[model samples]
Target: MYQVIPPCMELRDHVSHFWFASWTAQQDRVQPVYYQTASCLAELAFAFRSSELVFASVQGHSPHAARYNAGGFLSIFGVSVFAYSLPLLFDVPPAALSGRFCTPEQLLGREGALLVEQVAGEADLPARVRCLNDFLKLRLRKAAEGDHRIIAAARQVMKPEVKFDLSAFAGECCLSPKQFERRFSACTGFSPKLFDRVSRFEYLLNNHRRFTTLTQAALASGYYDQSHFIRDFKQFAGCSPQRFFALSGY
Candidate 1:
């Protein structure tokens, strides 16, 4: 089973949501699960029965999902960080994390280890979420404020049906195109063009039900043609649009 819960009010600015999942094996065998690439956000995940906590990056260039094995019983609690919000809570730059998974100790030092122990001790999911919230609050107190302009730009990029002209958008933000590209990459781990591409793909995924056909979905999401849409859909999702829709039960 999988579920998503909204972040607490205090965490809304930096965190998107808290997600949980659990699965039990029907037999003594490993099951494979493919986690699709998300090019616009970062994730911090804790496994209740394992030490390998995962901090996954915005996979801007990766063409395949992250694969994992599951057997017996497994459970996970994850914090979904909003785009560009990682630097606000952790010292690591978003660009440094692209297409990689870092351990808690690698990202947070000794404190991360202690947090792992504390979270593992809690058998209840809500209590574990509270612990994570407290940890994030402490980190926020010590961290510098993030630039709001990037967040604003991200919002604009995500709007459906908007024509994304990077040069024009950069000018509106009072930045040269090159300057905008550099700062945007530092903040979101993706160049403005790449971010727009990913955002368009995501829109297609989320709103496929609203369209009568895959071609319509592609065109409505801003792809210029079927081939362009299919290429990007395959690159980001690791499957053709038809297969992805089927797998996702859309």
Candidate 2:
């Protein structure tokens, strides 16, 4: 079974959703692997009663097709944290955890480790949700304030319809270009310029149905030329636009 719910109202800005999923061993064997795609969002997942030391993950954007193979019976509860929310939620920078995961106990030491145990013992899904929410809310209190300037910069990148000039936007935020680049990269795992490229590619991918033709899609995505568009998509999706769309059944 699979289920998803929104975070409590207080955590909505930083958190995208909370999810739960489970499958039997036979089901796992039937559909054993899944591929990941380029994404700006970070995710945190917890495994329940699994053989893998109750796996905990806090991961960042993936640039390619990372694969995961299913094993045994599985149940997982997780949250999707917005990319900019890294600064609002964790002591670690977004770049620090990009493309990889670390144990909760390792990341937060004793408190995180204890919470993992408590979650395992919690009676029902609602109780477990509360346990996780309380932990996050408490940590949010201790976390440093998120840089609204950088958040705004990310927003501009996210909205490709707006004309964006990296240096000009930095000036608007009262940050030097270099300072803006550093802080944006630290929070988003991509510099403003690169994030812009990814955002355009993301638009192409998400709206693949309308972009049925390669030339039209590339131009519509704001790329200067078809070659540049294909190059960026290859890097982000691990495949050319044509190949990716065909395989994805677009």
Candidate 3:
């Protein structure tokens, strides 16, 4: 079973949501390989049964291939971290975390190491949730004045019908082209082009039910045509679109 909750109003700018899942060990529990593409966000995930807390960062800073992994059993609680909000969550910089997973203890020092044991000892999911929220709320800070505009521009590029023009958009933001590119990369971990590509792939992967056919899904996700869609699918998913959809458990 699983549950998901949006971050509180104060955290809406930095966090996407808080989610938890529980599983029972069984001889026949279904285990499947998952082909995951990159994202513009990072996540802190905890697997209580195994006493594991990991920071997952598949932020597509480069055009890398897909990441493959398998899942088994556990009780897990996770918070999705936004690209620009990394500093507010941790003293670490966002650029350092691209395309890798780090244990919280490795990233946060002794305080982080203690969090694993502390949050895991909570009596129930609600207790766990409160524990996590209290910890994060203490670290909150006001977003930088420029961050508001940068993040707003980034959001415009991810719209279903994206109409992005590098020079024009930069001018609109009152920044020179190079200045815009630099700030955009600093705010999001990737160049604007790579982020748009991976984000489109992420959108269709997560929102498969929004369309009934490949063409509909491709076009709605801002792809120019089927051929380009297939190319990115193979690049990020490590398989043809057909097999990606044909898998028994995703």
lDDT (Cα, 0-100) at 137 in candidate 2: 90
Candidate 1, residues 157-242, lDDT tens digits: the string is 87767888888878888999998888888888887888888888878877878988888888999999989998888888877767
Whole-model Cα lDDT of every candidate shown, in order: 0.75, 0.75, 0.72
The 10-residue segment of model 3 with minimum total lDDT is 53-62
- What CA RMSD would you report for each candidate? 3.2, 3.7, 3.3
Q: Which residue runs does candidate 2 get wrong by more than 4 Å?
A: 1-3, 27-31, 49-54, 202-230, 240-250
The clash tally of candidate 3 reads 0
RMSD of 3: 3.3
Error of 1 at 96 (Å): 1.1
Model 3, span 34-68: residue lDDT tens: 35555766777776555553332223233455655
What TM-score does model 3 achieve against the real structure?
Answer: 0.83
Clashing pairs in 3: none
- TM-scores for all candidates? 0.85, 0.78, 0.83
Q: Which stretches of candidate 1 lie over 4 Å from their true place?
A: 28-30, 49-64, 71-73, 210-212, 248-250
Q: Comparing 1 and 2 by TM-score, which wins?
A: 1
